[model samples]
Target: MASSAIKHGELVALQELDSSSPLFKQGASLRVTGKLQEYCVGTAIATIVDGSVSLKIDTQHLRDLNFRVGSIYQFIGELLIQSDTDAVLQARVGRNVDGIDLNLYHQSMHLQRQFEVDYMRTRTT
Candidate 1:
């Protein structure tokens, strides 16, 4: 089985891991919690149920998604903080896990850090 990769500018649910936790470092397995609506670079605008938070991301490989407002999703992606807005996105990796796990994670050390071919749309071999 392969692990999924993450990106930027996507919404997610995060439950930060403790510093003592092994998954405290970058690229750790995180639990899905919620989803985000919009993200920029340095800061991201996200909502959780009836409330929301102004948080930061920890990755770069971003997969742009048009998130719906107040909707909760378990999407997994890289976390990024930009000058304008923060982002959670799908990143490229050696292992093959669909970037669209549509899941989320935690472990905010606060240190963090897509493309298409339709068929370039026709060969699944």
Candidate 2:
């Protein structure tokens, strides 16, 4: 059989990861949105924050992309968890999303999860 194709990134909130939530698999591809808190050019690392949750992102592979602090951005990457309180994203793609309503997005994500759970339960019944 042919090898399975790569999966699309899963949309997630920083809070879910920072809180050490068991909602996603380790090293899973993720799509997260947050405001750029800071960036270290020398280290090629950037910090993005949503609410009280913050995550460090490795930007070494994204040298072509310019990151501006305080700007809202969405990133698709692989999640790397070193510990309960430490996690990093190896960014593969990024883009600005300054116009997005983060609160609404978060609420929708919660609803989506509920729907998925219900659908799965129905299927297994």
Give the number of the best model, judged by lDDT.
2
lDDT of 1 by residue, 1-125 (tens): 88564433232334432344343444443433443444455543333221344333332443454445444444344433233333333333212123333222233322221113434344553
lDDT of each: 0.36, 0.85
* Ten-residue stretch with the least lDDT total in model 2: 17-26
TM-score of 2: 0.84
**TM-score, every prediction:** 0.32, 0.84
Error of 1 at 39 (Å): 2.8
The weakest ten consecutive residues by lDDT in model 1 span 107-116
Could you give candidate 2's per-residue lDDT for residues 35-67 as a string of tens digits? 999999999999999988788888888756778
Per-model tally of clashing residue pairs: 38, 0
Candidate 1: residue 123 Cα off by (Å): 42
CA deviation > 4 Å runs, candidate 1: 1-13, 41-55, 58-64, 77-125
